[model samples]
Target: MKDIILRLNKLFESRIRLGIMSILVVNDWVDFKYLKETLDLTDGNLASHLHSLEKNNYIHVRKGFIGRKPNTSFSVTDVGRKEFKLHLNALERLIKNI
Candidate 1:
């Protein structure tokens, strides 16, 4: 229905963003390098998508040093988890209706 379609969050419309959420939903925390490798994204590309999610408060970031190198990790917020679930449910409903 129209209401169901409306429930699909535009923030997750991007395959990249959707993939990010999928990974984060399962893992406690994911590092930038691991995400980039898994998603096959360039540094700039992943950074851009991450920035968008961070701006929306759907994901949180932690930056620290591992010995001498800088390490950055990401995790989904509670809000993000709820919204992603709603979006997935909307997609399921759409598929069933179709």
Candidate 2:
């Protein structure tokens, strides 16, 4: 339980990263537009946060032209899914124990 708690704490170390992770857990894939809309973040703000997550290998980017416009999509990787679930489970366990 202690080890799980430590790992979960690491997973949510940053505010923006934590929010991004929570969103990814629920949605298989999300668009840049959707993330900005849902989180009420500016373009630069969202892009930077997404980049951080990508750098950490927690999320993957799929960029392409949607018709004539550029579109960026994000999907959580397999490792990310496992870690996020573990974080969630740890939180639930800790709460239940309390």
Candidate 3:
């Protein structure tokens, strides 16, 4: 229905963003290098998508050091989980209606 379509979050419209969230949803924390490798994205491309999610408060970031190297990781927030669920439900509803 129209209401279900309207419930979908535009923030997840991008495939890259959707992929990022999908990984984060299952894992408690995912490192930048691992995500880049898994998603097959360049540094700039991944960073931009991450920035969008972070700006929306859908994901949280942690920066630290792994021995002598700097490490960055990401995790989904509670709000992000809720919104992602709603978006998925909207998609399901749309499919069922069709």
Which ten residues in a row are the worst by lDDT in model 3? 1-10
Model 3: per-residue lDDT, tens digit, 4-44? 87898999889999999999999999999999999999999
Per-residue accuracy of model 1 over 1-98 as CA lDDT, tens digit each = 88888999999999999999999999999999999999999999999999999999999999988999999999999999999999999999999998
Cα error of candidate 1 at position 59, Å: 0.6
Give residue 30's error in model 3 in angstroms: 0.4
In terms of lDDT, the best-performing candidate is: 1
| Clash count list over all predictions | 0, 0, 0
The TM-score values for the models, in the order shown, are: 0.97, 0.81, 0.96
lDDT of 2 at 12: 60
lDDT of 3 at 38: 93
Backbone clash pairs for candidate 2 read none
Provide the lDDT at 47 for model 1: 97
